[model samples]
Target: MKYAVFTGATGGLGTLCVKELSRLANWMVFAGGTKEAELEKLGKLPNIIPVRLDVTKQESVNATLEIIKSYTNKLDAIVNFAGMTSFTSLIEGESVEAIEKLLNVNVVGTARVNRTFFDMLYQGHGRIINCSSESGWMTPQPFAGPYVLSKYAVDAYNDSLRRELIYLGIPVIKIQPGSYETNITQQVYENFDKTISNTKYYKKLLTKMKPLMMMELNQKNDSRRLVKTVIHAMESRHPKLKYRVGTGKLLAMLELLPEGGVDVVYKLIFGKQGHL
Candidate 1:
């Protein structure tokens, strides 16, 4: 049986990924999270085993590995879907602390898991699929400073790992999808409130962005489509280095433009005062 370890199985996209992977009879999947009760519930399924994994802590990862030993010695894949995003405005003195928190989870935590599982992946000639976002490359927007920084780091991290893993016959793949229907969007307004509070400039900026945020929440791409693409990356004989799904092209085009061009586009969309 092919065994895979999937982290962040509790998030919106991760939940969908977990559900789909559970349906595959040939695949034995370890759904990773810190919630023991939820993980135990998922473990009730035929091929799914839930493991209490905290990627940020070495001890937790080591403990989880020991559990895996009881099941299988080889791992066919490690899917990192665990991540978080927060809104911030650097100009408003939004602390780098938020960025650090996200990096701890999205970048450092991911590296930790991959490093801990390297032997298993190498022994099985497995793959690593990281869930990134179009924010990795697109021009920075008004309130997503911290999130953009973390995603850019993710893009670079994936690239470096992919190069190193090539000779080892392990594929490091990145899936960059545009806005998808997820809980993240639903929390944007709340994030904005937390980040923009106590700052006059950002409060004004929020007035302008409220409508845009609402519209974006309604415009989320079909998450099932992204899930399908992800499954294809897992099953394909030769997967692409990166998979772009949904509004990826639109965001990619934004990246192609100069900074000034991007600003102009934003102005056109959000108005001269940055209000729709």
Candidate 2:
């Protein structure tokens, strides 16, 4: 039986991907956050086994992997959509510790997943999808420093691993979602506020910066786009190296702009983000 695995099965895009992949695979086993309730609900699906997983912790990841490894010797696929975001501006914003957490989950955690399952994917010639960001493209967001940096790492890691795994010929596809209808916008704003209250760097400037928070919260994209993208990536006769989904071609054009120009343009567009 072909089995698939996924991370971040409790939330927005993760939930959508879970449903879509579940339909395609004969059986699906996935990992979730600290919440046991989420795991319980998700496991109720027709052929799903939701395991408690904390991607940032190596030991926790190992323990979860052991259960999965013992269950299935042949794994077909894995999708990484587990991520967190904050609206801290680099020059004048939140704590360094927050940024550290982002790197741990967004960058290191990703590498860990691919590395941990290297043996499985190789032996089975499986596929892996890394949920990258458009911000990692030529469009460098002003207040989204941590997110951009981590995504950039994912992109590069995919490239390096793809080359090394070529003898195995397992496909590695990167999915870049522009924006989708998710409660993440509200969540990020909440994080921004909490981070700002205790932060001293740019408290005054950020206090007045509520517009950027609302703009991100209001940005819209179709959730179905991700479902379609994932399905295509899995079933396509010749899956491309990367696929980007979103409502905006603006960021596409931004990808063509030089680094200097993109930076200048963002400064003109958004005077100040979550940073002072």
TM-scores for all predictions: 0.91, 0.86
**Full-model lDDT for every candidate:** 0.81, 0.73
Runs in model 1 deviating more than 4 A are 91-94, 248-253, 267-276
Candidate 1, residues 202-274, lDDT tens digits: the string is: 5655777777666655675788988898888887889999997776444567788899998998777666544
Q: Which of the numbered candidates is closest to the native, going by highest lDDT?
A: 1
Clashing pairs in 1: none
Tens-digit lDDT track of model 2 for 1-276: 666668777777887777666665455656555668777877777667788878888887787778888888756777787887777766554447667888898878888887787677666678888888776564666567887788888889888877876767888888877766576666777777775786666565466556654654566667887788886886676899999877346556667778888877766764554543
**Candidate 2 Cα deviation (angstroms), residue 100:** 1.2
Candidate 2 clashes between residue pairs 3 or more apart in a chain or in different chains: none
- Deviating ranges (above 4 Å) for candidate 2: 92-94, 194-213, 247-253, 267-276
Name the TM-score of candidate 2. 0.86
Give the Å error, residue 45, model 2.
Answer: 0.4
